[model samples]
Target: MAGWEQTRRRHRLVHDVAGDFARNGPRALAAWRPAIETEFGGLDDLLRDVQRRLHTAAEARLDALIEAPPADLDTSVAAVLDEVAEIYPDLRRLLDAHASHPAVAEGTVRFHRSVRTATGVDLTRTRSDRSRYEEKGPVRDRKPVFFARLRPVCGWLH
Candidate 1:
């Protein structure tokens, strides 16, 4: 790809990764809390350390991008952006490294609250799988209620 495309792709990737973490990280932690605690019952200190490091690393990545001056796409800018993308995988891995523990999940209640506030959607709404699907006959509609609800949260017509 061209240099500009590479830079744009990196920025997009960062945006995607951060959003994912912000949105799902809490639930992931909450979902597996029991297992996390079970496996590391005596490691609260370690888990806290890991969580702190992970948060710091994520912040550092954002800080780097935020501190960067706006520049028109160019070869140098592309290189820097690519370098930033290079750390994406590592950041993801770190953020999720302690996801196997129950304590982390328990700890994520606060995180989930913050994310919900920022996104303006309750986690229950997004995480729910309680909707049932019904088959529609010919010339009939299916899941009108479910689809209608989805429009408000997902903001689109089905």
Candidate 2:
């Protein structure tokens, strides 16, 4: 099937499964869970793949900076930042999709707190700032400039 058709089918499947679960409760959900996973597992897999790729790229970038700092270090750093900027939206989408699930929501809260404690960076604050920009207009207009400014910090960290 075409991609759009597959997406539509999945959408219908989700609605049907949800309706069934609501009407029939836990027993129905238990029966349907495997099918639900079969249909939706690819998304979770894709998110994991993206995360692994991002981690590898980040490590490679950091290694490059440590081994032989480039002449135009800012540009090198910007490239890595740009890669992160590109990948982050997909991660956000996957997380947002699962945010309604109680377990996922609780885990996300714990992870956010851990990150804040470890990195001294408040993800909630950053998310809020990003939201403000999104509300104003297209992020494409601002992303490049924001990443450009961020390059200096990246360089300093290295």
Candidate 3:
């Protein structure tokens, strides 16, 4: 935190994590998602995108280093991998917790839609039909939602 500024910040730290990292180069994430649905049709695609983003961010941070390689980079990636390996257990807990609730997911869709319709902060760039990073996949009940899309940028720091 000394030399480097606190360049990035996210409120939904745990949930929008992949979205957070891909802000640095969201084109990478945009290329990966085959589709995006309201209730999240394919968790695998999201998970894969998250993993790829993690790898890309970590590698980019390390590669852009002007100093000698930090002694802990390897160990750090290892530790991160170890924690990511625990993804299933964590996911199981989350799914178990949300299994009984459906509105909670639907509400997420409303939130995005509201952002598109109401926000003063223009997100139009991200939702463009021509965007290379268009969100794709099936939504709840495997029905494709409207063409609503997002490129998932890195916020300001990202």
Q: What lDDT tens digits, residue by residue, belong to model 1 across residues 1-158?
A: 59766445433433443444446664544544454454444346435544443434433333343455344323222223223223333333433455557756664555446434543334444421111111111212332212221211111211
Q: Give the better candidate number (2 or 3) by lDDT.
A: 2
What's the lDDT for all of these models?
0.38, 0.46, 0.33
Candidate 1 residue spans exceeding 4 A from truth: 1-42, 56-91, 94-97, 121-158
Q: What is the descending TM-score order?
A: 2, 1, 3
lDDT over C-alpha atoms for residue 10 of model 1: 38
- In angstroms, give how far residue 30 of model 1 lies from its true place: 25
Task: Report the CA-based lDDT of candidate 3 relative to the real structure.
Answer: 0.33
Q: What C-alpha lDDT, on a 0 to 100 scale, does residue 67 get in candidate 2?
A: 66
Against the true structure, what is each candidate's TM-score?
A: 0.28, 0.35, 0.26
Cα RMSDs of all predictions?
A: 17.7, 12.1, 19.5
What CA RMSD would candidate 1 show?
17.7
Considering every candidate listed, which one attains the maximal TM-score? 2
